[model samples]
Target chain A: MARIKFSTLTEQMFYTLLCLKEECCGMDILDKIPEMTDNRVNIGSGTLYTLLEQFCECDMIRETKTEGRRRSYILTKTGREILEKEYMRICAQAEDYRRFFSGDK
Target chain B: MKDTKRRIELYSFFDHSGIEKHLEKMAKKGWILQKITNLFWVYRRANPQNLKFSVSYCPSASEFDPSDSETKNEYNEFCRHTGWNYAASGAQMFIFYTELENPTPIQTEPSLEVEAIHRSVKKTIIPIYFILMLLAVLQGAMFVTNLISDPIDILSNSTSLFTGFGWTMLFILFAAELSGYYLWRHKAKKAAQQGEFQESHGHKTLYCVTLLAVFIGFIYWIISLIINSSYFELTIAVIMLFAVAALIFLVNGVKQFLKNKNTPAKVNMTLTVVSSFVLSFLLIGVVTFGIITAAKNGIFDRESQFYQSLYLDSPPLTVEDLLGNEELSDRYITQISGGKAVLLGKYEIRQYARSGDSDAKLPGLEYTVTVVKARFMYNFCKNHLIKNKDKTEGGKVIFADHYEKTDAAEWGANEAYRRYRSANYVNQYILCYYNYIVEINFDWEPTASQKSIVGDIFS
Candidate 1:
């Protein structure tokens, strides 16, 4: 049973979790990430495949259906919790930056 | 004739980057790699095209599997869906090529690729290379010990010397190859952490040079066999071939054992390694026993006709001549060593004597006479013994002298030759008579009269 090793989410990991909020096949997530990130981040198929395997192994994602080699996965409850925690962390950092800017003004 | 051709080339097993580059070059030249065999890569001619090749390692892939299983096929299909077409595979390595304008890389995640390669290396190359290096080191230690104890014996045994050198070269090559892969992996990991791909470095030049050296050594070894065409050499060649075959069989056995997917990979890997080691020990034991048995029944049997045949056809002075008018004292004669080849003949005899018949002749007069019939063999024996005498015989430095006679007929010898004392062991001499080299060692310094007698026997 591997716990999430990363203390903080990488951009790809965060965006991938964001896309999996709705049930989506692996290939679709690859396509959706670029559109969602405004082309700032592009996840290669190999990266997505490996990350999906790792996520499934860590119980962060579960396969809902498999049509041929195309697999559809949804974020597990554990995955949603981790994603929410990461979102809160990013929000706190943004809040600190805002406070610093206002103090300067 | 088939439309395709096969080429035999030597490449380091772990040289993924170099291999992909080479395949790409070949593709441009219209040669498409179709399959890989033990020592060759089969290729089919195709229209020249620009192709990108990617090599990867899968721990589950095996050399023993005759056909791809369902899982392997599915894996290949998965890669195909991504535009990477499977080209060839060997052991744990897989190669894929694509002509697509924009092809998805097979290994997008560097860390995962690194882990896969690590697993494959651990399962295959590392264990075998480590064991071979250990054996090479052990062999080198043995050679040093032997040279120290009996330099003369090591000089006479060229097979062991060359074998030791060959093993040493292989060990160095393996070390270079292994370390190159390790350093590449380390750098690759660091680059991957920065979201960059690092190509695996391959030692193409080192691999080529080592292979060329081995090829030349193999040819020289064969020439040596032909020059020294003795039954002993024949037996040794047979044993060597058997050992090589047994090793291949043992490796295949491990691969076949690991093919059963029911067992965990870790457990399978452990079992494969343990069994390979045990079977290798068994192989060594069997080969050693065969060699010892052949040696004992063949050369060491002084009474054997084959051993007796190496002696002189006609001797001017026999054992009886040496006894002279003195009492018989003590006499012991052993064949000691003997070999015969197409152009060379070798015979060694160790004889002991004492002035009295009692056993008090503890370190009595000992004679070690070695007779070699051919020029090459004689020269080899002479040079090695003389050049290494000081290092091999470690004791008080006594005296050394040498002389040559251009007029051999006047000296009562058949041909012109030289004689030298390596270091005073009482007396140690390397004397050439006609085409033969006759080395004589004695416990007491020989007088002029005794020297003439020995020379007369050769003449």
Candidate 2:
């Protein structure tokens, strides 16, 4: 069975939405992810291009400005909501791991 | 030494890993990828370097899209920032290369890559293959039907046999390609779920072998035609071949010209398709008109003095042998035609009175001799000839016209059948000998002596 689109955010998708919160140009997100993660994670250029297009189509991102071939985008309300849900899901998993390791019910 | 080279590469649309590895090898040999067309992949001379290559798909991109379209430009800008330089693109496929040792790859997500490849293949190769497979199936079905209904006609002609073989080979090739791609996709999707990119290696050997076989078959067909056909037939065949080549060249030229002028993708495609249909019809019309004109000019006339003299030179059996009239033999015209295929060979000889001659009412003799080459086909050929001796029309059998078994010893050592219509005897007989089935018809009934002569000459 195929995964439903945007049902759960992959690492690259999560960071991409996080970078677009500031209305940054599309190419800047490629570098911003690594900088924000202390060089721990990086998104490929082709991957970012395709993700941005798909995001725009699903109304998760909207174009903010255009300068020739360089375009800036900002996260939509739906995008922010999805990102927050994913963040909470990760925190819940961490809490469960901590509880099990500490021998707590 | 030439600085540019072109080769026909038979890479599947989704075989990105294979293509990338091939390009890397080419780069090491100092040939850099430049451009790709439907027929050829072109490369330019460059200094040898250990470069890394990536193949990515843009599902929405059209081959007719302008080179500097905004979407393509923006995509290129994104790649340039990551140190990946554009190499070449054809249809929905894009290739990039980088000199950096650890440059970021163009595609990193396995699932996304698979989705993009599927989209691109659906938009291009899938439909084309489906259409070709349908045509092949239809042709193969027709060939089978002909083989069942008229086995002797197909078995005796090299052209028909080759056509059937060619279509069968094409169907196998296309079916294998389609099934192979789908099976790969199935496995690749499972691998992608495990965060891996499955490698794709198509049946390149099958493609090469099928193409070579078809080419050899085509050459054999042409040679057979040349050996068996007259000059007029050979000329017509040459013209048809040239016409087909011209049609392809002219259509592609038009499409390229429009693309160069920055025509919109939809308009360019529409115009190209419309022009192809028009040009095809025009070429067919021209060929038909030329044939009609040639016929009007008596180019196909076989009754000329030259042809008459050639036909008069040799005839296996004549009416003179049966009627014992040497003077009447000079007024008769003879025609001989035959062809051979793998299964069998057939030749027909006809001797009749010349047109406009006072002896137009003279008797004529015609006979066809089928020589079965393969022992396995001998019984099949013999049975078909016997069964087909009866006449049928509009899905109903004509009971009045049929063959009745006769004594074999009269004709020679084998079986024989004489024809009858409405309780009246017809001067026709089907004689079966070892490896030969002869059907002979006479304007008048053949005497026992005449049958003996035919059995001796044709057995």
Candidate 3:
């Protein structure tokens, strides 16, 4: 079957999970995404957390600890798996596109 | 009025305040207050030509923003922002967009790093679901074990917390849990699809704990009974159950306390070393049991009094009597017995809960009678209410569940919307014997409304 690109909703979810892979809480997540993108993309705390929340809701983000004020999110095995498949999917799709249209390298 | 079907529509959940400040933000996205419906604010962008949608909230936008009146611009921006076949509504803050061919869930532009996390989350939940089911099974086994051993064990523990006034309420809770467990699978599907983290979490943890608590109560009984020589044994069993449940709560509570320190409600005196007082006072002397038994006997001087004490019908009918539809049911039903309306009608139980399937813990059957009220008999069988006693039917036994009067807020939930969302698998049943059906007495007040306001419009 032909591969497809990630939608914006999935993009928000993936990046939020990546940002949350480390010591990111709700506030940290709110901050890190804008910094990583250099202000190019900005999403609401509700929207960003809502997507990562789906991961947590699905038990994909087991909580670690709450330090001063924020609850931290760590990637679950399921989260890591989702990330990997999306990565390979992009790779496979890019490879197919290049092979058919742009040849070498 | 147009013969054409209306356009795409969707609804959203928001903190009432957040939606107020962001009305224009939402309005620009093609949402506006609904004029007609009660406690509902509608949002529509029909092209005036095709699509239609509605959103509902209790208070209108005027309740919040007094100054800025117009909301047209927000609707325009929403219409221009996306390229989709349709969008139904964007009420409060959530935007629900639908396309001609519904969009496949994917991220269009993702960095290599971001792609990896999604793959991992997918793998983790498979086992989590399994672990959750196992936990549920373990919890159910505990209830079964306890019921098989002693019905009085659960009754006593419940009476301790709720008192005699709580029997009906407790039964309701048990019933809700029993029935709710079946519908809980819907939660798994709904949680996976919707973006509400809190509801999803509640569904997961409550399920594990409900069955677990009953299990703890069951085990406590056996241990207490064996070590009955000492008053300390009973105390220890009670305290131990309380402690284990408390410990689980305290661990989670302490974390929440630290996170939400700014909120005053979080300052709740969550955990304490109150066992010292409990040990010192020692309420487990033979006096306590003597008093309870005496209360049971003395309060009901006559057999009629006995029925009143247990909130049962005066003339106890066998399961056969309730099932067979005897003629006496007609004689005593409509008359004004003693000053009250004698309600004796057997609702033909033709169940029609299309939304309720076998996957549902409760089959969602409603009694076809005077009216189907969600506030009646709590279902004990659903949460796999354990039966150590004789089964009237092949595997059914009747027990009173009287924990319905608990204020939802006391349980740390909003009472209006909580309903029986986290109840163990108990359903309210009308067990029919031969003729007269022993069901919820209409005189009995109920737990809060069976329907929840939390996700009412959408869920």
Q: Which candidate should be chosen as best, given lDDT against the real structure? A: 2
* lDDT sort, best first: 2, 1, 3
Return the top candidate by TM-score.
2
Interface RMSD of 3: 12.1
What is the TM-score of each predicted model, taking all chains together?
0.70, 0.89, 0.25
**lDDT score of residue A11 within candidate 2:** 88
Residue ranges of candidate 2 with Cα displaced over 4 Å: A1-4, A64-66, A102-105, B302-315, B318-338, B348-360, B388-415, B420-425, B433-436
Give the worst 10-residue stretch by lDDT in candidate 1 chain B: B306-315
The superposed Cα distance between candidate 3 and the true structure at residue B60, in angstroms, equals 36
lDDT of each: 0.67, 0.83, 0.36
- A47-76, model 1: which lDDT tens digit per residue? 566577768878889999877766789999
- Name the 10 consecutive residues with the lowest summed lDDT in model 2 chain A: A1-10
Error of 3 at A54 (Å): 12
Tens digits of per-residue lDDT, candidate 2, B327-442, equal 78678777766677778877777887788987557988898878888989988887787774445679776766778899877787489988887658888888998988888899
Name the lDDT value of residue B144 in candidate 2. Answer: 96
Reference-based lDDT, residue B250, model 2: 97
RMSD of each: 7.3, 3.8, 23.9
TM-score of chain B of 1: 0.68
User: Tens-digit lDDT track for model 3 on B126-191?
Assistant: 344445555545555566566555332333233232222233233333444434433433543454
Kindly list the per-residue Cα lDDT of model 1 for residues B164-251, writing each as its tens digit.
6677778788888878878888898899788677876677787787777877766766665555435455556867878888887877
